[model samples]
Target: MTVRSEPVLVWDGAIRLVHWLMVLLVPLLWWTAEEGHMDWHRRLGLAMFGLVLFRLLWGLFGSWTARFAPMVRRIGALPSHLARLRQRDSTPSFGHSPLAVLSVFALLLALATQVTTGLFSVDVDGLESGPLAIMVSFETGRQFAEVHEFNFNLLAVLILLHVAAIAIYRFVLRQKLVKPMVTGRRPRADFAGADLPDNRARPAAMIATAIFSLACVWALGNFG
Candidate 1:
Protein backbone atom coordinates (compact mmCIF):
# COMPACT_ATOMS: atom_id res chain seq x y z
CA MET A 1 0.00 0.00 0.00
CA THR A 2 1.43 3.31 -1.06
CA VAL A 3 0.77 6.30 1.18
CA ARG A 4 0.61 9.78 -0.30
CA SER A 5 2.28 12.18 2.12
CA GLU A 6 2.63 15.58 0.53
CA PRO A 7 -0.34 17.95 0.24
CA VAL A 8 -0.57 20.50 -2.53
CA LEU A 9 -2.49 23.74 -2.77
CA VAL A 10 -4.29 22.75 -5.95
CA TRP A 11 -6.70 25.73 -6.04
CA ASP A 12 -5.13 29.14 -5.72
CA GLY A 13 -6.69 31.68 -3.36
CA ALA A 14 -8.25 33.67 -6.22
CA ILE A 15 -9.86 30.52 -7.52
CA ARG A 16 -11.19 29.67 -4.07
CA LEU A 17 -12.45 33.23 -3.58
CA VAL A 18 -14.32 33.22 -6.86
CA HIS A 19 -15.75 29.80 -6.11
CA TRP A 20 -17.21 30.74 -2.72
CA LEU A 21 -18.18 34.20 -3.87
CA MET A 22 -20.47 32.71 -6.49
CA VAL A 23 -21.86 30.31 -3.91
CA LEU A 24 -22.83 33.22 -1.68
CA LEU A 25 -24.01 35.55 -4.42
CA VAL A 26 -26.21 33.06 -6.31
CA PRO A 27 -28.89 32.60 -3.69
CA LEU A 28 -28.95 36.25 -2.74
CA LEU A 29 -29.31 37.27 -6.35
CA TRP A 30 -32.13 34.76 -6.87
CA TRP A 31 -34.19 35.68 -3.82
CA THR A 32 -33.80 39.41 -4.21
CA ALA A 33 -34.66 39.33 -7.91
CA GLU A 34 -37.77 37.23 -7.30
CA GLU A 35 -38.95 39.35 -4.36
CA GLY A 36 -38.75 42.64 -6.29
CA HIS A 37 -35.76 43.93 -4.36
CA MET A 38 -34.66 45.36 -7.66
CA ASP A 39 -32.21 47.88 -6.28
CA TRP A 40 -29.95 45.47 -4.41
CA HIS A 41 -30.70 42.60 -6.77
CA ARG A 42 -29.66 44.60 -9.80
CA ARG A 43 -26.50 45.66 -8.02
CA LEU A 44 -25.70 42.07 -7.15
CA GLY A 45 -26.49 40.95 -10.68
CA LEU A 46 -24.06 43.46 -12.14
CA ALA A 47 -21.42 42.38 -9.65
CA MET A 48 -21.94 38.73 -10.52
CA PHE A 49 -21.80 39.52 -14.21
CA GLY A 50 -18.48 41.29 -13.80
CA LEU A 51 -17.15 38.46 -11.65
CA VAL A 52 -18.22 35.86 -14.21
CA LEU A 53 -16.45 37.76 -16.97
CA PHE A 54 -13.34 37.88 -14.83
CA ARG A 55 -13.60 34.14 -14.18
CA LEU A 56 -14.03 33.40 -17.89
CA LEU A 57 -10.82 35.21 -18.66
CA TRP A 58 -9.10 33.55 -15.71
CA GLY A 59 -10.20 30.12 -16.95
CA LEU A 60 -8.59 30.87 -20.28
CA PHE A 61 -5.25 32.26 -19.07
CA GLY A 62 -4.76 31.59 -15.36
CA SER A 63 -3.06 28.72 -13.50
CA TRP A 64 -2.42 25.26 -14.93
CA THR A 65 -5.32 23.54 -13.18
CA ALA A 66 -7.70 26.45 -13.61
CA ARG A 67 -7.64 26.37 -17.40
CA PHE A 68 -10.75 24.80 -18.95
CA ALA A 69 -8.72 22.55 -21.21
CA PRO A 70 -7.31 20.74 -18.20
CA MET A 71 -10.26 21.04 -15.87
CA VAL A 72 -12.94 19.88 -18.30
CA ARG A 73 -12.32 16.39 -19.55
CA ARG A 74 -14.09 13.96 -21.90
CA ILE A 75 -17.71 13.11 -21.01
CA GLY A 76 -17.09 9.37 -20.96
CA ALA A 77 -14.81 9.69 -17.98
CA LEU A 78 -17.72 10.73 -15.80
CA PRO A 79 -19.66 7.47 -16.08
CA SER A 80 -16.47 5.47 -15.54
CA HIS A 81 -15.68 7.37 -12.37
CA LEU A 82 -19.22 6.92 -11.10
CA ALA A 83 -18.99 3.18 -11.71
CA ARG A 84 -15.90 3.08 -9.56
CA LEU A 85 -17.88 4.81 -6.85
CA ARG A 86 -20.52 2.08 -7.02
CA GLN A 87 -17.89 -0.54 -6.35
CA ARG A 88 -16.49 1.36 -3.39
CA ASP A 89 -13.17 1.72 -5.19
CA SER A 90 -10.90 4.70 -5.37
CA THR A 91 -10.89 6.96 -8.43
CA PRO A 92 -8.06 9.12 -9.69
CA SER A 93 -8.72 12.81 -9.21
CA PHE A 94 -6.44 15.74 -9.73
CA GLY A 95 -8.64 18.76 -10.07
CA HIS A 96 -12.30 18.18 -11.07
CA SER A 97 -13.87 15.02 -12.33
CA PRO A 98 -15.28 15.19 -15.86
CA LEU A 99 -18.90 15.76 -14.82
CA ALA A 100 -18.01 18.45 -12.33
CA VAL A 101 -15.89 20.19 -14.91
CA LEU A 102 -18.79 20.16 -17.36
CA SER A 103 -21.16 21.48 -14.71
CA VAL A 104 -18.87 24.41 -13.91
CA PHE A 105 -18.47 25.35 -17.53
CA ALA A 106 -22.21 25.09 -18.17
CA LEU A 107 -23.06 27.18 -15.12
CA LEU A 108 -20.57 29.85 -16.08
CA LEU A 109 -21.78 30.01 -19.66
CA ALA A 110 -25.42 30.18 -18.57
CA LEU A 111 -24.77 32.89 -16.02
CA ALA A 112 -22.87 35.00 -18.52
CA THR A 113 -25.66 34.77 -21.07
CA GLN A 114 -28.39 35.42 -18.54
CA VAL A 115 -26.66 38.43 -17.02
CA THR A 116 -25.85 40.07 -20.35
CA THR A 117 -29.42 39.59 -21.57
CA GLY A 118 -30.94 40.90 -18.34
CA LEU A 119 -29.01 44.11 -18.75
CA PHE A 120 -31.34 44.95 -21.65
CA SER A 121 -34.52 43.34 -20.35
CA VAL A 122 -37.66 45.31 -19.50
CA ASP A 123 -40.50 44.44 -17.20
CA VAL A 124 -44.20 44.34 -18.23
CA ASP A 125 -45.01 47.55 -16.34
CA GLY A 126 -42.41 49.50 -18.40
CA LEU A 127 -40.69 50.49 -15.16
CA GLU A 128 -37.18 49.22 -15.99
CA SER A 129 -35.09 48.20 -18.93
CA GLY A 130 -31.42 47.40 -18.57
CA PRO A 131 -28.91 50.17 -19.17
CA LEU A 132 -28.02 48.80 -22.57
CA ALA A 133 -31.60 47.94 -23.51
CA ILE A 134 -31.64 50.68 -26.10
CA MET A 135 -28.69 49.18 -27.94
CA VAL A 136 -30.88 46.47 -29.47
CA SER A 137 -34.35 46.65 -31.02
CA PHE A 138 -37.28 46.31 -28.63
CA GLU A 139 -38.53 42.99 -30.04
CA THR A 140 -35.17 41.22 -29.83
CA GLY A 141 -34.53 42.61 -26.36
CA ARG A 142 -37.87 41.23 -25.19
CA GLN A 143 -36.98 37.76 -26.38
CA PHE A 144 -33.61 37.92 -24.67
CA ALA A 145 -35.31 39.17 -21.51
CA GLU A 146 -37.56 36.13 -21.45
CA VAL A 147 -34.59 33.83 -22.02
CA HIS A 148 -32.81 35.45 -19.14
CA GLU A 149 -35.61 34.67 -16.72
CA PHE A 150 -35.86 31.07 -17.90
CA ASN A 151 -32.10 30.60 -17.61
CA PHE A 152 -32.18 31.85 -14.05
CA ASN A 153 -34.63 29.12 -13.09
CA LEU A 154 -32.52 26.51 -14.82
CA LEU A 155 -29.42 27.69 -12.99
CA ALA A 156 -31.20 27.29 -9.67
CA VAL A 157 -32.01 23.65 -10.39
CA LEU A 158 -28.43 22.94 -11.38
CA ILE A 159 -27.12 24.50 -8.19
CA LEU A 160 -29.41 22.41 -6.04
CA LEU A 161 -28.23 19.26 -7.78
CA HIS A 162 -24.61 20.25 -7.29
CA VAL A 163 -25.17 20.75 -3.57
CA ALA A 164 -26.85 17.38 -3.29
CA ALA A 165 -24.03 15.64 -5.08
CA ILE A 166 -21.50 17.18 -2.72
CA ALA A 167 -23.54 15.98 0.23
CA ILE A 168 -23.55 12.43 -1.08
CA TYR A 169 -19.82 12.51 -1.59
CA ARG A 170 -19.31 13.77 1.93
CA PHE A 171 -21.57 11.42 3.88
CA VAL A 172 -22.28 8.40 1.68
CA LEU A 173 -18.93 8.06 -0.01
CA ARG A 174 -17.03 9.21 3.05
CA GLN A 175 -15.10 11.81 1.09
CA LYS A 176 -14.43 15.40 1.98
CA LEU A 177 -15.32 17.02 -1.33
CA VAL A 178 -16.24 20.36 0.20
CA LYS A 179 -13.24 20.52 2.53
CA PRO A 180 -10.67 20.72 -0.27
CA MET A 181 -12.67 23.58 -1.78
CA VAL A 182 -12.66 25.47 1.51
CA THR A 183 -9.07 24.76 2.60
CA GLY A 184 -7.47 24.24 -0.84
CA ARG A 185 -5.96 21.03 0.51
CA ARG A 186 -7.28 17.49 0.60
CA PRO A 187 -6.79 15.15 3.51
CA ARG A 188 -4.78 11.97 2.88
CA ALA A 189 -7.81 9.76 3.44
CA ASP A 190 -9.89 11.58 0.86
CA PHE A 191 -8.45 9.54 -1.96
CA ALA A 192 -6.98 6.16 -2.65
CA GLY A 193 -4.40 7.66 -5.00
CA ALA A 194 -3.95 11.29 -5.91
CA ASP A 195 -2.14 12.46 -9.03
CA LEU A 196 -2.35 16.22 -9.28
CA PRO A 197 -1.28 18.69 -11.88
CA ASP A 198 1.92 20.73 -11.72
CA ASN A 199 1.07 23.80 -9.70
CA ARG A 200 2.19 27.06 -11.26
CA ALA A 201 3.66 29.72 -9.00
CA ARG A 202 1.18 31.89 -7.10
CA PRO A 203 2.64 35.12 -8.42
CA ALA A 204 1.91 34.11 -11.99
CA ALA A 205 -1.74 33.18 -11.35
CA MET A 206 -2.33 36.45 -9.47
CA ILE A 207 -0.74 38.54 -12.19
CA ALA A 208 -2.83 36.92 -14.88
CA THR A 209 -6.07 37.23 -12.88
CA ALA A 210 -5.42 40.90 -12.10
CA ILE A 211 -4.66 41.77 -15.69
CA PHE A 212 -7.79 40.01 -16.96
CA SER A 213 -10.04 41.51 -14.29
CA LEU A 214 -8.81 45.04 -15.03
CA ALA A 215 -9.32 44.64 -18.76
CA CYS A 216 -12.95 43.53 -18.26
CA VAL A 217 -13.70 46.51 -16.01
CA TRP A 218 -12.09 48.87 -18.47
CA ALA A 219 -14.12 47.51 -21.35
CA LEU A 220 -17.36 47.56 -19.39
CA GLY A 221 -16.81 51.15 -18.37
CA ASN A 222 -15.96 52.35 -21.84
CA PHE A 223 -18.59 50.44 -23.83
CA GLY A 224 -21.22 49.45 -21.32
Candidate 2:
Protein backbone atom coordinates (compact mmCIF):
# COMPACT_ATOMS: atom_id res chain seq x y z
CA MET A 1 0.00 0.00 0.00
CA THR A 2 1.23 3.50 -0.80
CA VAL A 3 1.00 6.19 1.84
CA ARG A 4 0.25 9.75 0.79
CA SER A 5 1.69 12.69 2.63
CA GLU A 6 -0.50 15.59 3.59
CA PRO A 7 -0.40 18.83 1.62
CA VAL A 8 1.57 21.72 3.07
CA LEU A 9 1.12 25.37 2.50
CA VAL A 10 4.05 26.55 0.41
CA TRP A 11 2.89 29.96 -0.79
CA ASP A 12 0.74 32.57 0.88
CA GLY A 13 -2.42 34.01 -0.65
CA ALA A 14 -0.84 37.43 -1.01
CA ILE A 15 2.15 36.04 -2.88
CA ARG A 16 -0.08 34.09 -5.22
CA LEU A 17 -2.32 37.10 -5.83
CA VAL A 18 0.59 39.34 -6.68
CA HIS A 19 2.15 36.74 -8.93
CA TRP A 20 -1.01 36.08 -10.93
CA LEU A 21 -1.87 39.78 -11.10
CA MET A 22 1.53 40.46 -12.65
CA VAL A 23 0.92 37.66 -15.11
CA LEU A 24 -2.20 39.49 -16.30
CA LEU A 25 -1.05 43.10 -15.98
CA VAL A 26 2.23 42.60 -17.82
CA PRO A 27 0.48 41.63 -21.03
CA LEU A 28 -2.06 44.39 -20.53
CA LEU A 29 0.72 46.93 -20.20
CA TRP A 30 2.35 45.70 -23.39
CA TRP A 31 -0.92 45.70 -25.31
CA THR A 32 -1.88 49.15 -24.09
CA ALA A 33 1.47 50.56 -25.15
CA GLU A 34 1.16 48.96 -28.59
CA GLU A 35 -2.34 50.38 -29.04
CA GLY A 36 -1.18 53.94 -28.17
CA HIS A 37 -3.30 54.03 -25.05
CA MET A 38 -0.79 56.01 -23.06
CA ASP A 39 -3.25 56.74 -20.29
CA TRP A 40 -3.98 53.09 -19.65
CA HIS A 41 -0.31 52.23 -20.12
CA ARG A 42 0.77 54.76 -17.53
CA ARG A 43 -1.85 53.54 -15.09
CA LEU A 44 -0.73 49.96 -15.62
CA GLY A 45 2.89 50.97 -15.08
CA LEU A 46 2.02 52.58 -11.75
CA ALA A 47 0.10 49.47 -10.73
CA MET A 48 3.04 47.29 -11.64
CA PHE A 49 5.38 49.54 -9.67
CA GLY A 50 3.14 49.34 -6.65
CA LEU A 51 2.92 45.56 -6.98
CA VAL A 52 6.72 45.28 -7.12
CA LEU A 53 7.07 47.43 -4.03
CA PHE A 54 4.48 45.34 -2.23
CA ARG A 55 6.33 42.16 -3.16
CA LEU A 56 9.60 43.60 -1.84
CA LEU A 57 8.04 44.52 1.46
CA TRP A 58 6.28 41.15 1.62
CA GLY A 59 9.60 39.38 1.04
CA LEU A 60 10.88 41.16 4.14
CA PHE A 61 7.84 41.06 6.41
CA GLY A 62 5.44 38.43 5.08
CA SER A 63 5.77 34.66 5.08
CA TRP A 64 8.92 32.65 5.66
CA THR A 65 8.51 30.93 2.32
CA ALA A 66 8.42 34.35 0.67
CA ARG A 67 11.38 35.84 2.55
CA PHE A 68 14.84 36.57 1.12
CA ALA A 69 17.13 35.12 3.80
CA PRO A 70 16.65 31.46 2.99
CA MET A 71 16.77 32.23 -0.72
CA VAL A 72 20.07 34.10 -0.32
CA ARG A 73 21.57 31.36 1.85
CA ARG A 74 20.64 28.79 -0.74
CA ILE A 75 22.59 30.78 -3.32
CA GLY A 76 25.86 29.73 -1.70
CA ALA A 77 24.95 26.10 -2.31
CA LEU A 78 24.04 26.64 -5.93
CA PRO A 79 26.96 24.62 -7.24
CA SER A 80 25.88 21.58 -5.30
CA HIS A 81 22.30 22.21 -6.27
CA LEU A 82 23.28 22.13 -9.93
CA ALA A 83 25.25 18.95 -9.34
CA ARG A 84 22.19 17.34 -7.81
CA LEU A 85 20.08 18.50 -10.70
CA ARG A 86 22.43 16.85 -13.13
CA GLN A 87 22.16 13.61 -11.14
CA ARG A 88 18.34 13.94 -11.19
CA ASP A 89 18.19 14.13 -7.47
CA SER A 90 14.76 15.63 -7.03
CA THR A 91 15.11 17.21 -3.62
CA PRO A 92 12.16 19.42 -3.03
CA SER A 93 12.72 23.00 -1.91
CA PHE A 94 10.10 24.48 0.35
CA GLY A 95 10.47 27.78 -1.46
CA HIS A 96 12.38 28.95 -4.52
CA SER A 97 15.49 27.04 -5.52
CA PRO A 98 18.81 28.90 -5.36
CA LEU A 99 18.92 29.74 -9.07
CA ALA A 100 15.29 30.80 -9.03
CA VAL A 101 16.03 33.36 -6.32
CA LEU A 102 18.55 35.06 -8.61
CA SER A 103 15.97 35.19 -11.39
CA VAL A 104 13.37 36.64 -9.03
CA PHE A 105 15.74 39.36 -7.89
CA ALA A 106 16.72 40.15 -11.46
CA LEU A 107 13.09 40.48 -12.52
CA LEU A 108 12.39 42.81 -9.60
CA LEU A 109 15.35 45.04 -10.42
CA ALA A 110 14.49 45.11 -14.11
CA LEU A 111 10.90 46.05 -13.41
CA ALA A 112 12.00 48.77 -11.03
CA THR A 113 14.33 50.19 -13.66
CA GLN A 114 11.56 50.12 -16.26
CA VAL A 115 9.15 51.97 -14.00
CA THR A 116 11.68 54.56 -12.83
CA THR A 117 12.70 55.37 -16.38
CA GLY A 118 9.09 55.57 -17.47
CA LEU A 119 8.38 58.13 -14.76
CA PHE A 120 10.82 60.52 -16.43
CA SER A 121 10.00 59.60 -20.02
CA VAL A 122 8.37 61.78 -22.69
CA ASP A 123 7.29 61.04 -26.26
CA VAL A 124 9.14 62.54 -29.23
CA ASP A 125 6.29 64.98 -29.81
CA GLY A 126 6.18 65.97 -26.13
CA LEU A 127 2.41 65.39 -26.29
CA GLU A 128 2.49 62.48 -23.86
CA SER A 129 4.72 62.63 -20.79
CA GLY A 130 5.08 60.65 -17.62
CA PRO A 131 3.78 62.35 -14.52
CA LEU A 132 7.27 63.15 -13.31
CA ALA A 133 8.58 64.09 -16.74
CA ILE A 134 8.14 67.74 -15.92
CA MET A 135 10.82 67.41 -13.25
CA VAL A 136 13.52 66.68 -15.84
CA SER A 137 14.80 68.62 -18.84
CA PHE A 138 13.25 67.77 -22.20
CA GLU A 139 16.48 66.20 -23.39
CA THR A 140 16.78 64.12 -20.24
CA GLY A 141 13.16 63.09 -20.44
CA ARG A 142 13.64 62.05 -24.06
CA GLN A 143 16.63 59.92 -23.10
CA PHE A 144 14.64 58.29 -20.35
CA ALA A 145 11.83 57.61 -22.80
CA GLU A 146 14.27 55.69 -24.96
CA VAL A 147 15.46 53.75 -21.94
CA HIS A 148 11.90 53.00 -20.92
CA GLU A 149 11.21 51.44 -24.30
CA PHE A 150 14.42 49.41 -24.13
CA ASN A 151 13.67 48.18 -20.63
CA PHE A 152 10.29 46.79 -21.73
CA ASN A 153 12.09 44.58 -24.23
CA LEU A 154 14.45 43.43 -21.53
CA LEU A 155 11.50 42.63 -19.30
CA ALA A 156 9.92 40.63 -22.10
CA VAL A 157 13.04 38.55 -22.50
CA LEU A 158 13.24 37.90 -18.79
CA ILE A 159 9.59 36.84 -18.73
CA LEU A 160 10.09 34.49 -21.66
CA LEU A 161 13.10 32.95 -19.97
CA HIS A 162 11.08 32.57 -16.81
CA VAL A 163 8.33 30.75 -18.68
CA ALA A 164 10.85 28.50 -20.41
CA ALA A 165 12.40 27.61 -17.10
CA ILE A 166 9.00 26.69 -15.76
CA ALA A 167 8.38 24.46 -18.74
CA ILE A 168 11.75 22.75 -18.32
CA TYR A 169 11.10 22.12 -14.66
CA ARG A 170 7.63 20.85 -15.34
CA PHE A 171 8.58 18.43 -18.08
CA VAL A 172 12.28 17.56 -17.79
CA LEU A 173 12.47 17.66 -14.04
CA ARG A 174 8.92 16.42 -13.45
CA GLN A 175 8.23 19.31 -11.14
CA LYS A 176 5.03 21.32 -11.02
CA LEU A 177 6.16 24.89 -10.57
CA VAL A 178 2.88 26.62 -11.32
CA LYS A 179 0.53 24.63 -9.16
CA PRO A 180 1.82 25.93 -5.83
CA MET A 181 1.71 29.50 -7.06
CA VAL A 182 -1.91 28.98 -7.97
CA THR A 183 -3.03 26.93 -4.99
CA GLY A 184 -0.54 28.06 -2.34
CA ARG A 185 -0.06 24.45 -1.30
CA ARG A 186 2.02 21.46 -2.32
CA PRO A 187 2.10 17.83 -1.44
CA ARG A 188 4.19 17.21 1.67
CA ALA A 189 6.14 14.55 -0.20
CA ASP A 190 7.59 17.29 -2.41
CA PHE A 191 9.45 18.79 0.55
CA ALA A 192 11.13 15.53 1.52
CA GLY A 193 11.04 16.25 5.26
CA ALA A 194 12.19 19.82 4.84
CA ASP A 195 11.33 22.11 7.76
CA LEU A 196 8.80 24.53 6.31
CA PRO A 197 7.29 27.52 7.99
CA ASP A 198 3.63 27.60 8.89
CA ASN A 199 3.30 31.30 9.54
CA ARG A 200 1.78 33.54 6.90
CA ALA A 201 0.98 37.21 7.18
CA ARG A 202 -2.69 38.04 7.33
CA PRO A 203 -4.59 39.44 4.36
CA ALA A 204 -4.81 42.74 6.22
CA ALA A 205 -1.04 42.98 6.16
CA MET A 206 -0.95 42.59 2.39
CA ILE A 207 -3.61 45.25 1.97
CA ALA A 208 -1.68 47.61 4.22
CA THR A 209 1.58 47.04 2.35
CA ALA A 210 -0.13 47.60 -1.00
CA ILE A 211 -1.61 50.85 0.25
CA PHE A 212 1.77 51.97 1.49
CA SER A 213 3.36 51.19 -1.85
CA LEU A 214 0.79 53.23 -3.78
CA ALA A 215 1.18 56.12 -1.36
CA CYS A 216 4.94 56.13 -1.85
CA VAL A 217 4.56 56.15 -5.64
CA TRP A 218 1.92 58.89 -5.46
CA ALA A 219 4.12 61.04 -3.24
CA LEU A 220 7.10 60.58 -5.53
CA GLY A 221 5.08 61.56 -8.59
CA ASN A 222 3.55 64.58 -6.88
CA PHE A 223 6.40 65.95 -4.78
CA GLY A 224 9.43 64.99 -6.83
Query: Against the unseen true structure, what C-alpha lDDT does each candidate score?
Result: 0.75, 0.86
lDDT at position 204, candidate 2: 80
- Candidate 1 ranges with C-alpha deviation above 4 Å: 1-4, 74-76, 90-92, 188-195, 218-224
Question: Candidate 2 residues 87-147, lDDT tens each?
Answer: 8776778888887998898998888898889888999999888888998999999999999
lDDT of 1 by residue, 1-224 (tens): 98666666667777788889888998898788779998787677777877887788778776776778777555568788778888865453667777678878888888888788888887766576666776887787788779989998888888888889788777776766777778787654445455556766466767767776667655554555
| Model 2 misplaced regions, further than 4 Å | 217-224
Q: Per-candidate TM vs. native?
A: 0.85, 0.93
Q: Pairing residues by index, what is the TM-score of model 1?
A: 0.85
lDDT of 2 at 119: 83
Error of 1 at 113 (Å): 2.1
Clash pairs of candidate 2? none
Distance from true position, residue 7, model 2, in Å? Answer: 1.4
Which candidate gets the maximum lDDT versus the true structure?
2
